[model samples]
Target: MEKMKPTLTVIMPAYNELKNLRGAFISATGALKIAGISDYEIIIITNTKRDGSHDGTPYVAEQIVKEDSRVRHIHNNSYVGLGFKFRQGIGDARKSFITWVPGDNENIEESVAGIFRHIGEADMITSYTSNTQVRKWKRRFVSRCFTEFCNLLFGLRLKYYNGICIYPTKLLQKVPTKSDNFAYMAEIIIYLVKSGVRYKEVPMEIKPTAISSSFKLKSVFEALGTIALLFWNIHFKRTRIKIGSIN
Candidate 1:
């Protein structure tokens, strides 16, 4: 039997992201090309219908599909949230490794190579965001408190939950999405910890422009909801299973 080539799947979920899709995709694929990982595909999932302002996300996605044959555009036919689109992208992935990069050009090019390099040793790899001075004091305090609470709640102290996550596709397939919204990332991380999957954290610098444009309040609520769900699973659910070491 011939050996099968390992594939890397990049899931980019977007909402009102027509302006950044092409740049983000070009940067990400360019970095991947430099890493010498030729077996890869980019899945762009858009939920523009729910954004309340027709930003022509779908049209832009179509244009991307036409321009980059390596990219696949998935329309959010049923769901209307970022989490839902991401879940669909993950479910459709047929690759050996999977990574999610924000569609707003936040993820740095160099970190993509770092993630692929570390994936050999860890089941999951996450990157930390660069500190920015433009954030409001209250937002910073809330994020810190929420992050600490997440560490305590899930026993996993990843610097940023949804910032940039890379993991084995099989691991994600084993423990699928429990929530269909923005809480999906948090739920996945908690599940990975509870399952004992070996994970690592690396520091990466995020673009200040991306940070300034992020939806902070909405992200906070999503994280809190994910933490609540994790507590429920720990104390009241029977989803515990052993995940092997990072050997």
Candidate 2:
């Protein structure tokens, strides 16, 4: 296969981010432009199923793309969950590097540039903020627990594996993405640990937002459950491979 242009393909998955979608793309694309990285593409995957129209995201994306060819928008007719959408976008990406920027716009331009630069040297680059300006206390606590659990289980202490992450496309190919929701983020981290890929962390400032739906107790539990499911998948699949060898 011909090598993809040395570009960064950013996948931003949205459920119903009609209000914040445009600004997110503008900021992201502008950041790359400021950094002089014109050879990049922003693939926005909008999952608007229950909304009055499925074309909301597509419309916004089209307007952005019209303004700049570097910006492209694709709509997911059927909501296949977060992990599935991320896989589809990254899978379709023709680039050397991949990043998943949240639709909420937490990852700003400077931070995006910083993270991408970090990924230039490392297989994976993660970021975190000691004071997440927009998140709730419960969400923060759960995030800390998840990070600690990952450290204990994988021996890698990454600051914020759950937020904006940039990695080489090769590493993503090596790791499987199975979560339907935000668990996809954690699953990626776990897979990286198992595959023994090189990784690094960077500090970032959390931009303020009044968005209340970003966090919920149920979502936290769902995230934890996703981690458990990943462990089960890994253990059972590994054992089956061993058994097949024996047979």
The lDDT leader among the candidates is: 1
Question: lDDT tens string, model 2, 203-229?
Answer: 766677654443566666777787787
TM, every model: 0.85, 0.83
The regions of model 2 sitting more than 4 angstroms off are 1-6, 50-55, 211-214, 234-247
The candidate maximizing TM-score is 1
Clash count for each candidate, listed in order shown: 0, 1
Error of 2 at 8 (Å): 0.8
- Give the Cα lDDT of each candidate: 0.71, 0.70
Candidate 1: the clashing residue pairs are none
User: lDDT score of model 1?
Assistant: 0.71
